[model samples]
Target: ARPRVGYYYTGKTGGTLFNEHMKKLTVQEFQSIPVVINDSASVYDAICTMFLEDVGTLFVVKQDSILIGIVSRKDLLRASMGKQDLESVPVSIIMTRMPNITTCKQEDPILEVAHKLISKQIDGVPVVRERTVNDQTVHEVIGRITKTNITKAFVHLAKDELHD
Candidate 1:
């Protein structure tokens, strides 16, 4: 094939093709099991869980894993500095509650999830599924999407591409 003087074909480089394939991927394809804590749990318990699980964030849930809020390591540290007893302070008091939390669904595009993480300045977002509880829409924490997960996905894609 020869290029005509005035002809142009849309250029598609490996980067462009990679971007397209990445966009088609979904959160569920790379999400990790969500580390969770009960909303009723104390701040002390949340800290313990964070260390025990080696996770920076914890999805706060209520009955049947219904998501209500999220707690981070910083939240626990701040609470620990308060005059109040850590064991007496519920995680709900220190968590970022619903209507304030960022979330994603299993079917959401991976590209969108990555953008949310970057724009929100958060390490992770809960991967949830919607449910009707008492006629109210609620989210159930099923998984989590983190920067590490996205990096792993990118590495895996690149590795596979190299082999191809």
Candidate 2:
């Protein structure tokens, strides 16, 4: 049987504290940081930087702080192989649009986030916060959670469990 996506929502408040603590530790302690690219950025430039940074994904965003899409390394490679000129093609053209992307909130439990990665067959999730300011809803990206983070957390838990 395939690994089941664990629904480990350990409540919102406690999850926040846990995520904060993870962030305070080394970058490796937390999940991989979400790489970002402007929607207007040239595909060539974005892909070049992504390769230089050694990251697998990039979150495409608009000027107004709205998430537009996600571009993975595979997506970039596929686009590059196509007939479109990299210099003229924008990331937006090849990005996975908003409604099709999966995301998580900072307050979600690390375990739950891990399950999401498994169930969705994704490597990571973007964290976002929705705020109602002046009666207008605004979404702001807070952080990212990934498979690496969950694995670290599980290792820590396993060690503690063994000790007990």
Candidate 3:
């Protein structure tokens, strides 16, 4: 294994290179635009926004894009079946509140986010940045990582093989 000649196999294979490339992929490189809704919005509004955005999940936030909660399609479906009028109800009532929400930063590995999406059995996760608001820690919604984003990254990763 001594470096005696040029172009000698260093014992690294294509698959190994691919694995290394995948591990280095970060969430910022593959995340999509975050879909958000005001915490005060109604369930009806949430449903409308979901449809309009064509996204599976929505981040609920306050005035400054500070993440307050998250809402999924399943949550909206359940809320619709409730006896209360959708307009009269606030989305905050159905959203999975902060401190309980699963979030990732821009620098997080895409593979890690993919693992989270699979193990958590969720549709998406918001990419956030932490900030201090009145000495209180809050997350700012920046982007989103979803199964679709992961799939795109996978496609891009395998693009080199397409030429062969």
Candidate 4:
């Protein structure tokens, strides 16, 4: 039989080493409530919704809440600067549509989501789940994973370790 190993300070038990635990954290544990908007909504309404919800990103969904696109503060700002009237312009004109929207599932590792946010240079990503409704498949936006959430989790982990 092999000899048993006791607790050893291998420089992996605290502080930055806490990141190991964070990497294994599931997205479901850190994902925040998703603020959604309809694809057909006007840019004016979308902006208002963003302000009311206090979110920088909005997940655009169909009438059935099927994920279709994503809109960010930058998109709104650009559209607002255009000559076109915000009340008359639909979000579909500026929203990043499906197939291009980066997403993470609830079961995805938080580190993976964090890498995606960093690699894509985005503020947030929608957390979705594939579901079949009326025999049609759709990605349903259930929550959101953002850089803020990841940072918050990391800080929380470090603080907990320090206290221990």
lDDT of 4 by residue, 2-69 (tens): 34676556656565666676677889988999999998899999999999999999999997678999
> What is the lDDT of every predicted structure here?
0.90, 0.74, 0.92, 0.89
What candidate 4 gets wrong by more than 4 Å, as runs, is: 1-20, 134-136
lDDT of 4 at 92: 89
Among these predicted structures, which one has the highest TM-score?
3
Per-prediction RMSD in angstroms?
3.5, 10.3, 2.1, 3.2
- Best-first order by lDDT: 3, 1, 4, 2
Give the TM-score comparing model 4 with the true structure, all chains together: 0.86
Give residue 63's lDDT in candidate 4 (0 to 100).
Answer: 76
Show model 1 residue runs off by greater than 4 Å: 1-13
Using lDDT as the yardstick, the better of models 2 and 3 is 3
Q: Candidate 3 local accuracy as lDDT?
A: 0.92
User: Worst 10-residue stretch by lDDT in candidate 2?
Assistant: 22-31
Candidate 3 lDDT by residue in tens digits, 45-127: 99999999999899999998999999999999999987999998999999999889899999998999999999999989999
